[model samples]
Target: MQRKIRFNKAPLLGDDLIYVEQAIKSGLTFGDGTLTREVESILQDQFDDAAGILLTSSCTHALEIIAILLDLNKDDEIIVPSFTFCSTASAFMMQGAKIIFADSEIPTMNIDPQSIENLITPNTKAIVVVHYGGLGCKMEKIMNIAKENNLIVIEDNAHGFFGSMNQKQLGSFGDFSTLSFHGTKNISCGEGGALIVNNDRFLDRARVVREKGTNRFNFKSGKIKKYEWIDLGSSYLMSEISAGILKKQLLNSNKIQMGRKIIWMRYLNALSEWAEENDITLPSKPHNYTHAYHAFHMIFPSFETTKSFLKYMEDLGIEAISHYVPLHNAPIVLQTEKRTKELNLCPNSSIYSDRLVRLPLYYGLELSSVDYVIEKVLSFVVEKQKSKF
Candidate 1:
C-alpha cells in the first residue's frame, strides 16, 4: 500500500499568486519592496513589538546578526542546550565565543534552566534558549538567571511562532528573538526569517546590518539623502517573493494553529493510556504554556525498541521517524572543539536523542490518517510485548 501519511505539507493558498502579481505590477521584485514593508508591519503587530522588525534570509542569519550586535568575541561563553538544532550554537561560534552545552529537562524536552545556572561563568555573554516542539521553556527561571548575571537572552524561537507562556508570546520575552519560516514550519515563505528586537539600542543598527551595513533603509524612508556602508554587516535581507509568501501565511495563522492543535491532541489522547501502561513517556503539557504543536514526539523505552518500532510502522505504510542527533555528538562539532572528552557530559541528551521518534502532525492532515497512525503504533507495541512472553 502507498504511504498513508506525509511528514508535512505546505498550504498552497492563493497568496503566492497575489504576491507574484503584485511584484510584477509594481516592477519591484527585489528586497525592500511594498510586500516586504507590509509584512514587516504585520509582524510588528503580531509580535507586539513596535520598535524594530528586520526580515532576514533565514533564522540562522537572524542569530548571526544578534551575535554581531552583541559584539561577542573570544573569551565570551554562550550557554546552549545540547539537544537542539546546530544553528543555535553555530550562530555564537561564528563570533569566536565558547559554546557551553547545557542539559535538557527530560519532562518537557526543553533546556533546563537550573542546568544553565551551573554552566555560566565569568566569560558567559548570553543564554540561547530553543523552544523545542513549539513549547515554551521555563522562561521565568531563565530570565531570573540572566537578570542576576546581566547576560543577554536570545531566544531561538525557530519552532515557536504563535506559542506563548503566561499569556505572553515567546518572541517578545528575550532581548532578541529569531523566528524561522522554513517550509517545515507552521508558517512558511519557502525560506525566510525575522528578528524581533525588543531593545531600542539595537534597532537602528539592526536595520542597517540586515541591509548589508547600508543606511539604505533610512534612504528609502527619506531619512537620509544618500546611504553608505556605516557598519560591519552582511546581506541578510529577504526578497519580495519570499516576503509575499510569508505575509500570506501570516494571514492564515489562526486557522493553521487550530488545525495542528487538533491533530496534536488526537495523538495525545490515543497514546496516553497505552504509553503509561507500557512505561513510555509522552510529551508534557504545562499549565501556563500553550504549545503550537509543531511536532508530536514520544520517547520509547530503549534505542533498540525505537528502531524496531519505526520499522514496524514503516511496514504498515506510516512514515513516522526520529529527530535531531545531538549537536555535541556530531562530527563537525567534535572537530571544532578538538576534544572527545566533552562528549560524555550530556548523558540526558544522549538518551533522548537515541530513543525519541516524531509522528506526522501537520495542517490539513485527514482525521482518518490520524486514526490510522495511532492504530498502527498500538498494534506494533502490542506485538512487541507478545514476543517477550
Candidate 2:
C-alpha cells in the first residue's frame, strides 16, 4: 500500500531547534520576552511602512487586538468577505459590531471592492479584507473606498505574510494587518501571529491593548514608573518559545517561500491545460502581485464533481480537501435572529465554497508525492469525463 500524503505537516526548518533551545536557556519563557521582542524587530525591519509590530498568540488574537484598538461600538458595521475564515468577522463581532458579508471576486477569491461598496452604510466603521491563498486583494480600489467613506481597513493577512502587491508588502498596505504562524501556514511556530500597525497613531494604544489594557510596555521601557490598567485589552502576547521558533522561520522565510513557489508553479503547469480543457478554474494571479504560494486550489464545475474528486484522492491515499464554508451562511453565523435576517447575500461565496478543492502544498511535501497527487487527480478528471460521454 502506498503511504498516505497528509494535507499539511509543520515544517522543520533549520534553526528551529537551535533557537528554541536558546530561548529555553535564556529562562524568559513568558510573553513579551527577548525572543518576542526580537521577532517584532525583525518584522519591522523587513516590512516597509510598519509603525509597530506586536507578536500575538494567534492571528485571531491579532485581529481581536485591532477591534479593541478601534473601540468598536454596538451595532457598528464591518464589511468582510463571506468566503473568509470565521475569525475575520468574529473579532469585530466580539466588540459588538455587525458583520456585513461581502462577495469574493472569482479571479483571486479575495473580497470584491464593488461588493464592499454596495454593503457599506452610515453605520459601517471598517472594511476587513482577506488575502486569499497568499494573493493580494485589490488594495488600490479597496483603500480608495475606505478613504472616501472614512472607514478603517484591516487586512486578514493570514495567508499573505511576506507576500506583496506592486512592490509593497500586503500587510503594510492597510491601517492594520494580522499574520498567522499556525502550523499550516507558510511559516510555522505551532501557534503564533503578529499585528502589524501601519499608522503611527495607533502604536501607543495598540501596545496598551496587547499588554492586557495596561501601561506595561511603557513601564518596561522606563517611560513610566510602573504598569497599570490603562484601557480595554486582552492577554494577546505570544510566548517566548513560540516567538523563538517564529524568529527562525521568519529569517528563513525566503527559502521556504521559494520552495513552496516551485511546488505551486509545478501544479499550475501540470494542471493548466487539463483544467482549461475541462472548464475547471485554476488559481489566478493579478499583475504586480507576488503570491507566497501558500495554498494551491482548483474550482470544479459542480459541487458533486468536487466531492467526487476529493473522495477519489482520499481513496488513493492523497489528502486533498476543501477550503472554508461560506461564513455568512454557517450555522453559527445564522443562529441569532438579527444575523439570520441580515442574510449572507453572497452568491459567489456559496459557489466557490461548494466547488473549490485545496491540494497539499507545504514545506516538506516531496516531489514524488506531488507527482503522485497530480497523476491521481488527472486520472480522476479523465475518468469522470469519459463517464459523462
Candidate 3:
C-alpha cells in the first residue's frame, strides 16, 4: 500500500518535547510563564522592535485581543479581503463592527488596495489586511490610504511571521499585527498565537485584554500594588506548555525556513512548465518580499479541476484541499446578504476562492515526500470544461 501523505503535520524540529517536559516539571505550566515570556521577547526583537508581543491561545484569540482594543461600535466598520479566514471578519463582528468585504487581486491573492479605498466610508474605523500565504500585501499604498483617512491598520499576519516587504518586517507596518503558531502555519506551537502591538498606546490594554479584563500584568510585573478588572477583555493566554514548544520552533526557524524554501522552489521549478501549458497559476512572491512559506497553493483552471485534482491526489494517498469559501458568500452572511448585487461585491475574491488549492508544506516533510508530491502534481492535468464559476 502506498503511504498516505497528510494535508499538514505540526513541525517538531528541535527541543519541543524537552521544553514541554521542562514546563511540566517546573510546575509553571500556566500562561506568562518563563518560556512564554522568552518567546515574546524573541518575537519582539525579530518583528523590528514591536512595542509589545503578547502570546495568546490561538491566532483567532490574537485577533479577538485586537478587537477588544478597538472598542468598536455597531456602525464602526472594518475592511478586510473576502479571500481570508472567517476569523479575519468574525473577530471584529463579535465586537459589533460591520465588516466591509473587499475583493482580492490576482497573482498575489492579497486584498486589492483599490477595493479597500472604494469600500471605505465615514463609519470605517480601520482596515485589516491579511498577508495571505505570508506574502506581504501592498502595505505602502494601504498605509498611505489609512493615513489620508486616519483609519487604523491591522495586519492579520497569521501567515506572515518571518516575512518582510522592502526589507521591513510585514507585521511591523500596521498599527498592530498578529502571528499564528497553529499547526498549519510555517511555525508551530501546536495551538498558539501572539498579538504584535505596533502602536504602544495599546500595549497596556492588550495585556489587560489577554488577562481577562484585569490589570494583572502590572501586578505580576511588580508595578502595581493590586490588580483589578479595568477593561473589557478575555482569557487569551497561551499556557507554558505550548510556549515551550513554540520557543524551540522559534529557535530552529532559520533551519526550518531553509528546508521549506527548498521544498517550495522544487515544486515551482518542476511544475512551472506544466502550469504554463495548462494555464494554471503557481505560487510566487514579489522580488522585494520574502515569503514565510506557510503553504504552497495553485489556482486551477476551474472549480471542477480543483475538485478533480483533490480527488486524484486522494486516490494516490495524497491529501490535497481547497481553501476559504468567501466569507461574504458564507451561509451565515448570505441570509442577510442574499441580494445578488451584494454577493457580487467581491467578484475576484469569489473566483479565487473557488479555484485555490493548497498542497502540504512543512518543515518535517521528508525530501522524498516533497519529491513525491511534486511528481503527483506534475502528472495531474487540468481538464478543459465548458462550465465555469
Candidate 4:
C-alpha cells in the first residue's frame, strides 16, 4: 500500500511538548499566564508594534475583536475580498456592518485595489484585505486609497506571518492585522491566533475586550479599585497551554520557514514545465515581496479538470483539495438583499473559484512526498492529454 499523504499536518519542529509540560508544572494553565505573556511579547516585537499583541483562541476570534474595536455601525460598509474565508466578512457583519465584497486579481490572488476603490462610498468604514497564500497584497496602492478616503485597513494575515512587502512586514502596513497559528498555518499551537494592534488608540480597549468587555485588566494592574463591564466584548483569550507550545514554535520559526521554502521551491521547479504544457496556472511570487509559503495552489483549466485532478490525487492517496467558493455567490449571501447586485461582479474570482486547488505544503512534509505528489500530478495531466488526442 502507498503511504498516505495528508493535506496538512501541524508543524512539530521544536520541543513543543516540553514547553507544554513546563506550563503544566507551573500549575497555571489558564489565560494570561506566564507562558501566554511570553508568546505575546515575542509577537509584539516581531511585528515591531509597541502598541501590543493579544493572543486569542483563533484567528476568527482575533477578527471579532477587531470588529468590536472599530465600533462599526449597521450602515458602515467594509470593503473585503470575495475570494477569502467567510470569517473575514462574518466578523464585521456580526458588528452590524455591511460587507462590500471586492474581486481578486490573478498573478497573486490578493484583492484588487481598483475594485476596492470602485466600491468605496461615504458609508465605507474599512478595507479588509487577505494576503492570499501568504503573498503580500499591493499595500502601497491600497494604503494610499485608504488614506485618501480615511478608510481603515485591516490585514487578514492568516496566510502571512513574517512575510513582507517592499521590505516592510505585511501585517505592519495595515492599521490593524490578525495572524493565525491554526494547525495548518506556518506556526502552529494546534489552534491559536494573535491580534496585532498597530494603532495605539485601540490598544487599551483591545486588552479590555479580550478580557471580556471589562476593566479587569486595568484592575489587575491596580490601576482601578474594581473591574466593571465597561464595554461590549467576548471571551477570546488563549489558554496558557497553547501559548506554551506557541512560544517554542516561535523560537524555531526560522528553521520551519526554511524547510517550507525548500518544499515550495521543489514543487515549483518540478511542475513548472508540466504546468505550462497543460495550461495550468501556478502561484506567482512578486519580485518585491516575500511570502510565508503557506500552501501551494494552482488554477486548473476548468472546473471539470480541477475535480478530476482532486479525485486522481485522492486515488493515489494524496490529499489535495479545492479552495474557497466565491463568497458573493454562496447560498447564505445569495439570499440577501444585495444578492443580484453583488453576484459575479468579480469575473476572475468567479472563474478561479471553481478552478483553484491546494496541494499539501506543511513544515514536516518530506521532499520525497513532494516529488511523489508532483509525479502523480504530471501523470494525471499526461493521461488527460493523451485521451484528448
TM-score of structure candidate 3: 0.95
> How accurate locally is residue 209 in candidate 4, as Cα lDDT from 0 to 100?
91
lDDT score for candidate 4 against the true structure: 0.88
* Candidate 4, superposed: residue stretches over 4 Å from native: 338-342
- Give the alpha carbon lDDT tens digit for every residue of 297-333 in model 4: 9998898999888888888899998888777776767
What local distance difference test score does each model get? 0.87, 0.88, 0.87, 0.88
| Model 2, runs deviating above 4 Å | 338-344, 386-389
Error of 1 at 3 (Å): 3.4
TM-score of 4: 0.96
Residue lDDT tens for model 2, 88-148:
9899999988888999999578899999999889999999999999999999999999999
Worst 10 residues of 1 by lDDT: 11-20
Error of 1 at 272 (Å): 0.5
Give candidate 4's error at residue 162 in angstroms: 1.4
lDDT per residue as tens, model 3, 101-161: 9999897789999999999899999999999887899999999999999999999998888
In model 2, where is the ten-residue run with the lowest total lDDT?
335-344
- For candidate 3, the 10 contiguous residues with the lowest summed lDDT are 380-389
TM per prediction: 0.97, 0.97, 0.95, 0.96
RMSD score of candidate 2 (Å): 1.6
